[model samples]
Target: MDINKIHYAEITISAVSPKQYPDDGLPEVALAGRSNVGKSSFINAMVNRKKLARTSGKPGKTRTLNYFNIENELFFVDVPGYGYAKVSNAEQEKWGEMMNVYFSSRDELSLSILLVDLRHHPTELDVQMYDFLKYYNLPVLVVATKADKIKKSKRNKHINQVIQTLELATEDKVMVFSAETREGRDEVWNEILASTRNDSI
Candidate 1:
């Protein structure tokens, strides 16, 4: 896809329930990650818009499902970041319920892009998110973000760690990404396109 052609993207809704989701029937790619994993930065980089998705210094800032309509061709669903320490138990339960309903029942959901910090191993919540996607038979692309923060020489080792720790299948693709330099942006978009195309079949 031409990155320059993505001129119509915007956040259409911040939904907490199915009734609030868009009814346009566009294929959706959901983004999942732990708190402060650079999901928003990924979205902004993908769309070539600096502030399309708000980036925050604090964790757990995104508490709802943010739907970004990309050129009206598809929707990028930004689910709330998991594994924040300060959130109340009740708030965590609500997030769990909201995510469960969307992941299990949303027919338009074509894929889920699970983002993990490239500088460290996948967190427990990251593993659980991957398992949840697999349990629901949802296609997944695991992205190790913040790649620029690590040395290029050590990147392979970190990527390998992420894969092994997550127990990713041989067929599953994992890309090292950096929102700062836009590294892996094209590859990520390609995966998104492929996933959505497969869903159309």
Candidate 2:
């Protein structure tokens, strides 16, 4: 895919309710991660846009499911981040319900890109999200973000740790990503293309 040829991309909707989801029938690739896991940076890097997904220093800033249309081919659905301690239990429950409804019921969802911090082991919430995707039989591609923060010599070790911690299957794909360096962008795009192709079949 030509990242340079991506001419049309924008947040079509910030959905608080499933009723507000776009009905265009385009395949959707969802971004799932804990708060401050660098999902926004990933999106911006993937699309070759600056500040398109709204990066923030604060965690849990994305409270809605943001749908971004990319060249009319597919939608990158940035789901709200999980595991922020500042949010109240009641708010977390609401977020959970919103995510559950979307993940389980949305037919357009082609794949869920699960992001985790590359420097540390996968969090309990990360594991839970991975499990939730598997429970629904959703295709997932694990992306270990912030790869630039870790040394190249230790990258493989960390990646292996993530695989082990997540208990990823042999066939499951994991990409080492760095938004700053754009290291894994091509691989991630290829996975997205393959997932969408399978979804269409």
Candidate 3:
């Protein structure tokens, strides 16, 4: 697939606030992951643009639902990364509530990309996120990021661990990607495109 035609069309922050999102026809793919797990970098890499989703070394920088229209066909929703931060307990609870609402009731959401760190196995937060997505019966594409950080021989073991942890059924659902190196960008894009087109809703 030629990805050169892909481009960012628009972006909206705090889209679910004020009222609710309009019933846009465009299929939406939600991105979810633990804080500082390179969620932004994955988006930027998939879109073939730098700084599109605002890469941050610090955790919990993105506190809102960010919507980015891609190639005018699909909307890439960057949901706030969960786990770890200096925020108050109440604030964290608020974030959790907001995320739950979005995940449970978003009509336009077609699929979710659950990003995980390839350097390590799935963390507790990651497992919770997996179960949460599964709980909603939402389709998820697991992206194992930072693949280059680990040795090739050890990569499969870690990936298998993630699959077992998430109780994934299909091996093809796991995507190994390196945002910094632009590796596996096309494969990830293919998965997104496939998910977007599959619209079971």
lDDT values for all models: 0.91, 0.91, 0.81
Which 10 successive residues of model 2 have the least lDDT summed? Answer: 192-201
Q: For every model shown, what is its TM-score relative to the native structure? A: 0.95, 0.95, 0.91
Q: Per-residue lDDT of 137-170 in model 2, one digit per residue for the tens?
A: 9989999999999999999899999999999977
lDDT of 1 by residue, 1-201 (tens): 466568799999999999999999999999999988989989999998899998887889998999999988899999999998999999999999999999999999988999999999998889999999999988899999999999999988999999999999777889999999999988888888878774221
Tell me the RMSD of model 1 versus the true structure. Answer: 2.1
Error of 3 at 184 (Å): 1.4
| Winner of 2 and 3 under lDDT | 2
| RMSD to truth, every model | 2.1, 2.1, 2.8
Each prediction's total of clashing residue pairs, residues at least 3 apart in sequence or on different chains, is 0, 0, 0
* Colliding pairs, model 2: none
